[model samples]
Target: MKHLFSLLTILFLLSCASKAQNSSKEKKTYKVEKTNAEWKELLSPMAYYVLREAGTERPFTSDLNKNYKKGIYVCAACKTPLYKSEHKYDSGSGWPSFDRAVKGNVELDVDYKIGYARTELKCNTCGGHLGHSFDDGPKTTGKRHCINGVALEFIPKEK
Candidate 1:
């Protein structure tokens, strides 16, 4: 009976330690860091508007929405893989939509711009604004990750 109690205590300690470690590894708030000159040189005006300034792109404007190849979609500002092509789907909203983000990647914040509540998506590492999330999406996840085109860069899978 005493040995069983000791084993239980050991397991409890190990579980607590793991929980603390995992919490520490979670992503935190981030801020953008780039000079205007560098941003201008690296991104077009529209891309800059949406990515750096948190402006929204008009619906159905991104070519990536129609993309069907297998690849990873990355943040255009920080090159962090945000979504997989397998998660992409046609939402007919004029923007690229993903049902989910890459595992252990990306970050989300509560946004209330224009008197409406939304979940703002951003790069976990750089904190660049990606876009908003909505509940109206296809079956499976019921999440519409309405992302701007200029905010992402696609890396097609090698054949």
Candidate 2:
């Protein structure tokens, strides 16, 4: 039975090492780093929650959901231009939806927060959480970038 015990111990150690490696890979390093205090000072309470803590805003509550004026939607944390106004759509999912993001401006990650895998979208500049993207979208892209409205600041196009 000594050989069986040895093999079991080896397997346990291997599993532990694999888990550590996976956890390390999951830690994200952002280009824009800020302390909690700095983020609190720079953002509204809701914005801080959604951007920093990956909290979701209440749906249909954001004025941006209905806003269709021509302009760019920028990251509330960093003012990086993210989504063009033309990509915005009424997904009726309560949150603002976009068909796509500006190239190289958004990062997609896998999220298993709800016991299933989801595509979590973040700002490439600040690494701030924007929302989730799904396969169910318009024919143009077939990808719904369901974004938290509180995480964005709209800059209307000048007349």
Candidate 3:
């Protein structure tokens, strides 16, 4: 019937428009650049794996999960300050959960590694894979930045 044909055409056009919108999202660029060899030499095995290879660390395995000190967490790769201790919290997800990150220090992108869309978080300066951010978080930001321990280094506050 012509009605059925017209409905199908409308659906097809809507799908195409949705795809175009998704693809138009901005991409992030980093300032620091290095070859794989250079990164490997500068980072530890676990840090390199999580930061460069987009690998996840075993939950509750990082000492940072238990750390409750006044400090700032920096990228293990480029030492860029990403999150502050005040924003860190226990999400019971086995990773270091932060309510937020320092503005302009982290970048977000979509990842489909697990057959689903996830907000992938990366260090803006080094372009290293930090982890993912979720909508389920505290009232402060309502954003949970789940970061890998191996991908971060805590710098104690200078008293």
Candidate 4:
């Protein structure tokens, strides 16, 4: 009985830890940092939900999901260029999908929000949660960088 009790306690703690990690903002130091109030003012409610709270927008709700143009995608909070137009693709995931990120401009962390580990992507400059990455993707890099449109600001390429 003693061993069983200890085991149950450990499992409970582990589950709680994962939940906290999923809901909380990353703790790592970012180059661009701002208080919650500052971030709230600079970002829209939806943007703040997706970027700071690590929330997801409803599928098929983003205008950028079907956008096909020449441009670069930058972090909404900080204008850090993340994905180039050439790398963007239609993964049918309802959110903006990119084959890869601009090298070192985005960061990846493990997320266990749904009881499974998913690769959570973040803006390297400001540490804003962008989205998750999956292994299923085009042959180029075999990386599906599933991103939230609200977390990105598209900048049209200068013609």
How do all models score by TM-score?
A: 0.76, 0.87, 0.82, 0.83
Worst 10 residues of 1 by lDDT: 25-34
* Tens-place lDDT digits, model 3, residues 1-159: 999999999999999999999988575557998989999999999899999999999999999988889999999999999999999999999999999999999988789999999999999998999999999999998999999999999999999
- Per-residue error (Å), model 3, residue 66: 1.0
Best by TM-score: 2
Worst lDDT 10-window in candidate 3: 24-33
lDDT value, candidate 4, whole model: 0.95
**Model 3 stretches with alpha carbons more than 4 Å out:** 1-28
Better of 2 and 3 by lDDT: 2
Candidate 2 residues 63-118, lDDT tens each?
Answer: 99999999999999999999999999999999999999999999999889889999
Q: Give one digit per residue, the lDDT tens place, for model 1 in 13-52.
A: 9999999988874645456567778887888898888877
lDDT of each: 0.87, 0.95, 0.94, 0.95
Residue 72 in candidate 2, Cα distance off native in Å: 0.1
Whole-model lDDT for model 2 versus the true structure? Answer: 0.95
Per-residue accuracy of model 4 over 1-159 as CA lDDT, tens digit each: 999999999999999999998998756999999999999999999999999999999989988999989999999999999999899999999999999999999999989999999999999999999999999999999999999999999999888
Candidate 2: worst 10 consecutive residues by lDDT? 23-32
Q: Could you report the Cα RMSD, in angstroms, for every candidate shown?
A: 9.6, 2.7, 5.3, 6.6
